[model samples]
Target: MAELLKAGAVFFVGFLALYLLIVLVVWLGQERMIFQGHVLPQHYAFSFKADFEEYSIPAADGAILNALLFRSDSSSRGVVLYLHGNRGNLSRWGHMHRPFTQRGYDVLLIDYRGYGKSTGKPTESGLYQDGEAALQWLLQYYEARKIIIYGRSLGSGVAAYLAARNPHQLLILETPYDALTNVIQHQALLPLPGCIFRHHFPTYRYLPAAEGPIYILAGSHDRLIPLYLSKRLQPLIGTPENFKVIQGAGHRNLAAFQAYHFELDRLLLP
Candidate 1:
């Protein structure tokens, strides 16, 4: 009986140690996992077909944020301040702005810190500052009512943060989560304490105070950020009806679907 008890205690201790090690590793490396930015050379020239003017916006903390201002072929209606996902630089994401630019709205896409030519490392707070700097730069030429804030995936939190603090024409979040904590917990193998995460986006907290029309787009088959997680954010919007679902679309492929364009047309086009 004594031997059996000792063996059981040893096995429990070993399992506990392994679990703690996993937690420590995850906690230490969560930033890399969350912000998967692709760095670019300082002098890398962008070769997009669209008419774009690139600029290096200055962040409050001395970070240089690289951005592209894509001018519309037709007369400008407004500008979409597009905050992109956690992966890739503006070169990869610039092509995704056709939906807005082709429809006569100029698109401004900024690379988060450590992404593209943007200097400094990325942090949740740093991204918010980067977004504010972008908006301030835009305000020099365009009125607040002419700026539409759009967030995608990881950028959703940044968009929400910006919208909550600034006045804009509209706020759009694609494949967003209620909170970063909720997303981390949902994707974890085993249940994890919320304290383990350093960045808690808390879009739900920002969405309530955001000015202007708030619209959320969700892909029916988004495995990265599931439909239900996006649905959880519907109640935060003043008009929950603005919550749009693109059927047959997944996280990254929503732009390929006709339904995605249809929804954008309904919301954006004259």
Candidate 2:
């Protein structure tokens, strides 16, 4: 009996040590989990130039978020609220600015919390809050124009949640995962209990509620999120007609795809 109790104690200690180690690693790698690396300053050298304005909008949670507003010289029919991927800031999105501007659509690129010069640490809830704040800012400023929410990678979850609640807006999701739990399960290779993670974005739960003109874009060679995940979301998202899969494109090289630019132009053009 004493030997059995001793063995149990030893097992308990081992389990506790492992749990603590995992917690430490997760805490240390939180920023790394979201942003890939430090975002360098970007200079837009595109042939077409748009009038750019920098703005800082206050979030509902009192965090100040930075954004770049690009307005075309021509008539503006609508605004594109661009929520970028996990890593990098609005500067990384400068490359795509010309396409939208050339199409006569205003582009608003935002930096979520802990991204670029935005304040506060990045949490899943915080990113959602940032998305809401950005949408609200546009509604206040561009009340007459149509608002389109464009999300890429991690931002897809944020855009999904917003679209679910407010169906009047247009939603364009690029290389999005089914849910936060799905991403953690597949990418982190952790067990099912990892669903208890505090930062779970849970986009899958919100898909059924989305009632808008939805557009889905995925890459055939996207190994990170995988093509199957996006394909799985098709039925759940009200059978979207704008689903597109770009050939020869991976997770990181989405910008290299001519199809990406073509789709954006086609979508923005009236």
Candidate 3:
């Protein structure tokens, strides 16, 4: 029995050490794991709009990010600064913004540093800087109060953080996680403490001080970002009307549903 106990203790210690090492590796390689972007071809075209005015905004750290400003058919209500998901570039994500443009709201979509034509390695803090830079560039043509920020998936954290810091009028988050740490833990068989995460896009942390009205649109059938996680945000915002969960909608295909736009219209028009 004494020998068996000693062997069991040794096995437990070894497993703990191996687990810590795995966590360390995940921490170091997280940036690459988080951001997936293709190399920008020299002839990369912006087919999102023919008259789409492209600009190169400089971050505080001197990284140059490429952004697209989609003008409305008529004079706009405001510009929607769209922070998109982790995959693809602004050009791909721009297809998702036609609802805003069709409503006479100009949409500004940005490629995070290292995505599409943008330069500089992407970090959590650097993403926040990129968002601010895009907003400031928009302010050159529109007032800060006129801008409404929208974020989807990975961009939700960036959008929430920006809305909290800036004077935007409205904030719309689609399938946003409570935090990146929460995302990783929820997907795991056994959840871990959030302290191990290095790339902390804590959207919940910023929601408390968000300056504008907050609207959350989440999918009831979202497999990637569970509905319960999105539901957790309701307590923080303290308003049932601010949160909406669409039936039979998944993470990537929520926009395809008519109910999605129905909810959006209620929020935008109301």
Top candidate (TM-score): 1
Runs of candidate 3 exceeding 4 Å displacement? 1-25, 193-195
- Give lDDT tens digits, candidate 3, residues 1-270: 999999999999998887777677666767777888765864687785436888889988999989888888987888899999999887678686688887778988999988999998888998999999998888898898889999999999999999888888789999999888777766654555566677889899899888868999999999888998888888776466889888999999988899899987876653
Kindly list the per-residue Cα lDDT of model 2 for residues 35-116, writing each as its tens digit.
Answer: 5524333343222245578888899989888788888778887888888888766666655666667788888888887777
Report residue 175 deviation for candidate 2 (angstroms).
0.6
RMSD of 1: 1.8
Clashing residue pair totals per candidate (backbone < 3 A): 0, 0, 0
lDDT for each candidate structure: 0.92, 0.77, 0.85
Measured with C-alpha atoms, the lDDT of residue 268 in candidate 2 is 73
User: Which candidate, 1 or 3, has the higher lDDT?
Assistant: 1
Per-model TM-score versus the true fold:
0.94, 0.82, 0.90
TM-score result, candidate 3: 0.90
- How do these models rank on lDDT, best leading? 1, 3, 2
